[model samples]
Target: MSAGPTSFCGIELAHPIINASGTFDAIAARRAFGDAVVERFPFSAYVSKTITPAPRAGNPPPRLWEEPAAMVNSIGLPNKGAEGFLSTDLPALADLPVPLIVSVMATSAEEFSGLVEAVSARDEVAAIELNVSCPNVHSGLIVGEQPSETEALLEALRPLTAKPLIVKLTPNVAAPASVAAGAEAGGADAVSLINTLKARPMFAGKPWLGAGSGGLSGPAVRAVALQQVSDVAAAVSIPIAGMGGVESGSHARDLLDVGAEVVAVGTASFRDPLAAERILIELRGLDPVAASSATSEL
Candidate 1:
């Protein structure tokens, strides 16, 4: 059996598999592996690393700690910022065979509006994903943790672009469903979840990461991803991109069964650069009919 095409927010994709933002760096991969990396690019749609208004130096190391079937990271979304990304990276990323979704973060609605306007103005960007994990500079409240904040942020950003706005929900909240509903009410075209669980790994009674606490990812967060995806699905009619510890075909299928329209490969890519391709092959083999059915619904 052969798999059919899938679409997210009006953008047609060859498959339902995509890369989690920040997990796969196409530019570095191309430098390491050359054109083969682009010739057989793994993800259906490529999501860029989180970008800010100004360049970020990122968090101090030790930034990573290995755990059983998981890893904690305090990478702090290092990027060359919006200007540098547009001037340097966007050209190379635009050359890839897949549509591009740019992930962005800001501390205020005003700042976020600027990012949306600038990024959407470029023809290379197929959509914009708002990374709502940070706190609002004015309210000092995490935008994704509170439904009101998420709704207000969406409302502020909705008018900036005709492109799809995907709200990347943080999993630390008590009820992610409410936040998802709020995003929908405020004009979000879709939502993606299970960004990573908060963790404080200790080494010799001292915090291992320089940031003290970091976000955990890998096979350890699969169950949490499913439950949150299920809850968010029930609360909104918008499409979903579910991810967290998805290392196999069965893991991807589980997220789809729960309600994710697309499954993003994260930590598995660190283990194998072509993990998304392997997982997509396995997914087609496991249940081509189910994959086809899900694509039809999308």
Candidate 2:
């Protein structure tokens, strides 16, 4: 069996498998592997690394700590700012075979509005994802952690553009569903979870990462991803792009069974750049519904 076409947020997708934000660097892969990476693009829709209003130096060294089936990262969303991305990276990414979804983060609604407006202006950008894990500069509250903040942010930015707005929910919250509901209520087209679990790895009784603590990812968070995805699905009527430690077709199937409209391959891509393709193939074998329901719809 072969994976059939699907749609997310009115955007046509070749398959339900897409890469999580910052996981697969399409440009880097193309530079390293040449056109082969582009010819066989792993994801149906490519999500760029999180871009901020200004350039970020990112965290210090010792940013990654590998556990048994997971890894902790304090990469700190390194990027060349929104203007740099629009000027330099956007041109290159526009050439990709798949649709591009730009992920943006900011500490305030004004900054977020600027990002959304700028990114959405580009014809090549198919959607915009809001990375809301950071603290708001005004209230000092993590927007994604609080339902009201999430809703208010979305409400402020909803009318900026007609493009789909996906709120990337943080898993640190006790009731992520409420936040998802808030996003949906405030005009989010969709919601994605779980971002990462807070972790402070230790080595020799000392903190391992330079940032002291980081977000945990990989197989260890699969169950948590499932639970949160299910919870958010029940709370919001919009679509979901579920991701955590998806490494196989069975894992993808598990997410779909729980309520994810699409599954994102993250840690698995670290091991194999073409992991999404394999997972899609395996997923076709496991779930015939994915193939039978090929019609495109929002």
In order of appearance, the predictions have TM-scores of: 0.96, 0.96
Model 1 clash pairs are 218-245
lDDT of 2 by residue, 20-85 (tens): 998888889889999988777878899999999999999997899999999999999999999999
Model 2 C-alpha lDDT versus the unseen true structure: 0.91
Work out candidate 1's RMSD over C-alphas: 2.9
Model 1 clashes, total count? 1
Judge candidate 2 at residue 33 and give its lDDT: 96
Alpha carbon lDDT of each predicted model = 0.92, 0.91
Q: Model 1, 32-60: lDDT tens per residue?
A: 99999988898889999999999999999
Return model 2's CA RMSD, one decimal.
Answer: 2.7
